[model samples]
Target chain A: MKLSKYNLGVIILILIASQAILAFLLFLGQPYFQLQGNSFFALLLLFFILELAALLIYEKINTARIKTSFGRFIKQIKLGNYESEESHIIQKYDFVNITDIQIELSELVGRIQADYNEQKRYIENVSHELMTPIAIIRGKLELLIQSEKITKSDFKLISQIMTKLDRLTRVNQSLVLLSKIDYNHYQDKATISFNDILDETLNLFEDQIRIDELVIRKDIKEDLRFNMNENLAYILIKNMIKNAVIHNIEKGYLRIKKLEDANGIQIINSGAVIHASTDQLFKRFQVEGGYQDSIGLGLSIISKICEVSGIKLTYTHHEGVHTVTIQF
Target chain B: MKILIVEDDLEILRTVLKYFDSFGYVLEKAKNYQDGLAKVNEFVYDCVILDLNLPDGDGIDLLAKIKQKNKSTGVIILSANSSIETKVAGLEIGADDYLTKPFHLSELNARVKSVVRRNKYEGDNAVRFNEIIIDTASQEVTVHSKKIKLTKKEYELLLYLVINKNRVLTKQSISEHIWGDFIDRTDSYDFIYSHLKNLRKKIMEKDGLDYIQTIYGIGYKFAEREIE
Candidate 1:
């Protein structure tokens, strides 16, 4: 049992009231029998002390029980267990003052959950429904282009239309990927070797690297490995390497190395200096440099993967040099 | 070659059928799961282009049934869900290949041809277009009985072109075919141009006629040139 300041004050008040009642009783009994005042007051004082001690212990135990029940309610809320049949909030938090707040909180959580589920279903349905039409249009265009009736001007129009269609397809796919990550779809994890993935990604962009005459450098003494979903790790690394190559200038350099002081890796590249704040770059559709090919979801995807994987990610650009560091 | 496409979307099915009509294949269509299952039970096709989101049944089960009927028949699962898990699951159940929705018809055609070629028992692996012969098994290209070296990207480009020969292949399709849909870049067209140039120069070095025709403002077409 613990005594807080408030409990202490209440105990003092109770003791004073009891002492008053005892003094009055002694005063009233003065006429009934001849008694030693000192002895009688001493006996009364002893009884009063005992009663005060009992009250303090009772108050402390009561307060402790309330604190624990309240703590359990908070824990349940934090874990999103609002719909539990035997929830602490419903069963134990039925005290006079707290019951109102608990009821309101549960209602709020229910509404939010419903809204979230609806939004998720809508996103899924829209993306799925849009794909069939896009496929049909693309197929029709392909068939149209094969016809001999299409003139030079018509071919140009078809080409432009095809480019836009490709863009639309990419945007839809990226959005679906983002929502999937948001919903914890990729929960499977495994030990992934950074060295192996980096090698493969670099090879994938080998043609572009050579075409741009970009210099490649690697500084790693040992293979870097981390545990993550293998598919996400591949995408994360591939996106990083792709950004490095795509945004790089002619004859620029790209360097990938293990962090000297941390359990992570860093990718440094020479590229055009950006004017937009770094925070905006990680947002969807925030394309810097106005590159026509960029859909600008790369950074967002990288950030999303990092967020879900519990990895520390930092992006810094100094002058013409851009650096991205991922700390596991 | 014989093929069956099981898709619920009528418009998509019609489009696919029309595009494949030029190939002279014995094409069949089933608009729902019941029809698809019935057709699969009745006929042993060389390939089945299956859409996973059937109206009445799961496509994976149909894929199993198709393979059970004939082990040599190739099944390519088409789906709108591009998740890695779905791809892995389909492939694990003996699916020959998987393609996501909004796919390129040319890419689909190329995959269908490749799948059929791979499942063929007699092992006829050579892809011959005029004097240009591509041995798919060895990844070798020969023109007029003379060997010519080609880079990996160049070789894939040549094969994709030769497989969908005479069709105006878009730069986007070509890029996606070789680099995949991951490398999203506008300048990939330039890479295509440079690679095609090198390919043209290499083929001409062996005194082979240039069959690659550039459709201005669009893409390339590999066909026998019509005399003007």
Candidate 2:
């Protein structure tokens, strides 16, 4: 709700008209003050102008009141009245808080732009991700159906199609989760132990690591904790370790060493040196070494966590080891 | 294991469920987030097939929720978002795998089978495809019972194609999968072509029918074409 009496010209014009009209009315209404009948009509006209000026000022006040309710309009939109018809604004007052309206409209436009950008990205990814298995299934099934003989060998392709379809299913879940993160879901910030969250998260993967014939070494400082949304933290650690395990050389070691200070924790992994630039590791659809299963979101989720919280995160490759440092 | 799918689109859900049912998989479903979460918290599943988009909540939130409840349950994130961000979410949430939408049901089965085999059938040694064999234990590949030697890149390419064969996989996908995500700095995909050519030659030399098909404006399809 904003009202500013900043237009001196309009105010001055009204003031002069009021003063002129009052003088003319005094001259016309008093017999002692009025000498000529010709000027009587002129005086009457001046009185009318003063009366009109008062009404105009009252109208201005009412219009300002109407515009002040714009906040309610915005709130309604947020509450899902996005499809509501635009309220028709009557009384064309030029230079009324047009800038404010523009700013709000611009923000609406920006959000729409963001939505489009996000949708475009998702479509490309879904198309790419979904298309792979579909193409495989369609192509293989097409081949198998046309063949005179279903080679005992061709049964494998059907199974292979099954495998990709399964991957497609998994990718879809990951995609849905990504959108959730984008919308800032799980944003209830709280104090969390860096080590505790890491350990708990690591436990989820411990059995898999053991089965894969890999060792898990931990050098995290006990009691090293900080304030953050625990859910995001869990996501950060789980993805980092998963990336380390999947990208590592066969029988290669998976290690978690956290360096804690007032700054933050650094989760370090010893695996095949990420040959790609450290930045790409965080990009969507960015995989390495033709690893089909890696939909390439390992570092991106960590980046999102940094964004939601005031945490600073950076990735570096030094001496064939990938280091993701998370600073509070 | 019976999987309960949470998807908004009935068509895709039906299609996917039908495909899984073909493979003798038992399935359950919910159309949105609340229903999906309820099912997840209530049931013990060997593996979960989760989607990224839901009407009530973000799929990622569900991911954290699911992981919090059962740390060991396998999760395979299924989404229309093949974004790097989403993939990382599943991985970070300790999900077993990630797949994207409009996908063939078969790819989903492969990842499901893999998760099951790894989680349930750990001692089973072979990940087999036709005459080609991948000893997941030793990371070895065999074509038609004759071992075809491959460079590291070639091996990965073969495995990727084999896993998603007959699919129209784009070159951009190939580059990302094989070369890591730092693909922006590179100049040409001629290397991918060269590798594909070499891989085809290796297979042909071993008397295997050439299966990699190039989709004109798009990418490659790893399926054997008619020889006529």
List, residue by residue over A1-328, the lDDT tens digit for candidate 2.
2334544455556766876777666766678774466676576566667766665676577657546645554554454222223322222223235457745654664466456556756755655556545644543453343234645455455545544554554455566556666655455678887777777667655434554567677876556667777767777777766776666655667666655445567666656644788777778778866656666665677687787677888888776576777777
Report every candidate's CA lDDT. Answer: 0.88, 0.64
- What is the Å distance of residue A81 in model 1 from its true position? 10
Q: Mark the regions of model 1 whose C-alpha exceeds 4 Å error after superposition.
A: A1-113
Best by lDDT: 1
Fnat of every candidate, listed in order: 0.77, 0.11
Worst 10 residues of 1 chain A by lDDT: A80-89
Which predicted model would earn the best TM-score? Answer: 1
DockQ of each: 0.57, 0.07
lDDT of 1: 0.88
- Clashing residue pairs in candidate 1, if any? none
In candidate 1, position A203 carries an lDDT of 93
Error of 1 at B129 (Å): 0.9
